[model samples]
Target: MIDKILNIKELNYASSLNGDNLKQKIEDLFERPAISFFGNFTSQTEFAAYDKLSVISWYVPNFKRKSAYLKGEILKSGKGTLIKLNIRPNTMLSVASIVSVLVGIIILIAAGSSTRFLIVGSFFILVGILYYSFGIFSRNRLRTNFEKTLDLHKV
Candidate 1:
């Protein structure tokens, strides 16, 4: 699958809780639909984006949207419940950003020798790099939060 090839961020945890208890813990960690910044989930395992605004790290979400959505799978094992989590990026958002940057570059090329177009194109390239860099930088933070919330021990 693409997930395996892309090296998506995955966390596997062995929880002592039974299936229902594990599910409940995950459910409890999510904010109410009205309070959530992202869409509500009806799936058995998927949760909302990591949108808990913290005074200590208030700006994390802005750059994090590219890679903060949560997807998970719960499997019953003989020893315990297994929680498989994927910290997936917002695909649509990522694609849109790329498309926009490409458009900006194209416009700059079409504008020929204009200094203004060059400046704007450079800004677009800088913004794109910053956006991707910050997303990658925050992925570990999101993983840590999931571990703390679920009391996960890495497997």
Candidate 2:
């Protein structure tokens, strides 16, 4: 069995076993994610897995309460097994985030009228960027950590 990361955000490769067997092995490797503390915050960092699918999520320390997660699916490809992972953010939060960034741009454009708008707009823009960035970072970090923990790259 050979595993490879197609990109920083996705991991997949070829396996000789069926999807059920492969998924079980992954579950065994991680066992269960531990709860860790950062300052006064106690957050859960873990994934839920089944025979053909897995969903991974963890807490982000950002001021805004946002959750990040990834979904993986196993499929049969040719004579081998193929596993793919991706983030689907078509939710309200994702939409609001994009709107925030656009609103920030509008505020900046209206800034010539008042410095107050500039300040507010800047704040919005910063928050929007952080929200978006944290979402991406969280998803990738979890996937990377999983691969590293299991030494999948070399497998």
- List, in order, the clash count of every candidate structure: 0, 0
lDDT of each: 0.62, 0.51
Q: Which pairs clash (backbone N, Cα, C closer than 3 Å) in model 1? A: none
lDDT of 1 by residue, 31-121 (tens): 4454322333457655555534321333454454334566677889889888887775445334444665786788688779999888888
Give candidate 2 regions above 4 Å deviation.
1-11, 16-20, 35-66, 88-93, 153-155
**In order, what is each prediction's RMSD in angstroms?**
6.7, 9.9
The count of backbone overlaps in candidate 2 is 0
lDDT of 1 at 22: 78
Q: Quote the positional error of residue 20 for candidate 1 in Å.
A: 2.9
lDDT of each residue in 43-145, candidate 2, tens digit only:
1222332121122244445433324344556667776666565543213345455678889999999898798999999888887776566555555555555
**Per-prediction TM-score to the true structure, in the order listed:** 0.60, 0.59
**Alpha-carbon shift of residue 102 in model 1 (angstroms):** 2.4
Best candidate per lDDT, number? 1
Model 1 whole-model lDDT (C-alpha atoms): 0.62
C-alpha displacement of 33 in model 2, angstroms?
A: 3.7
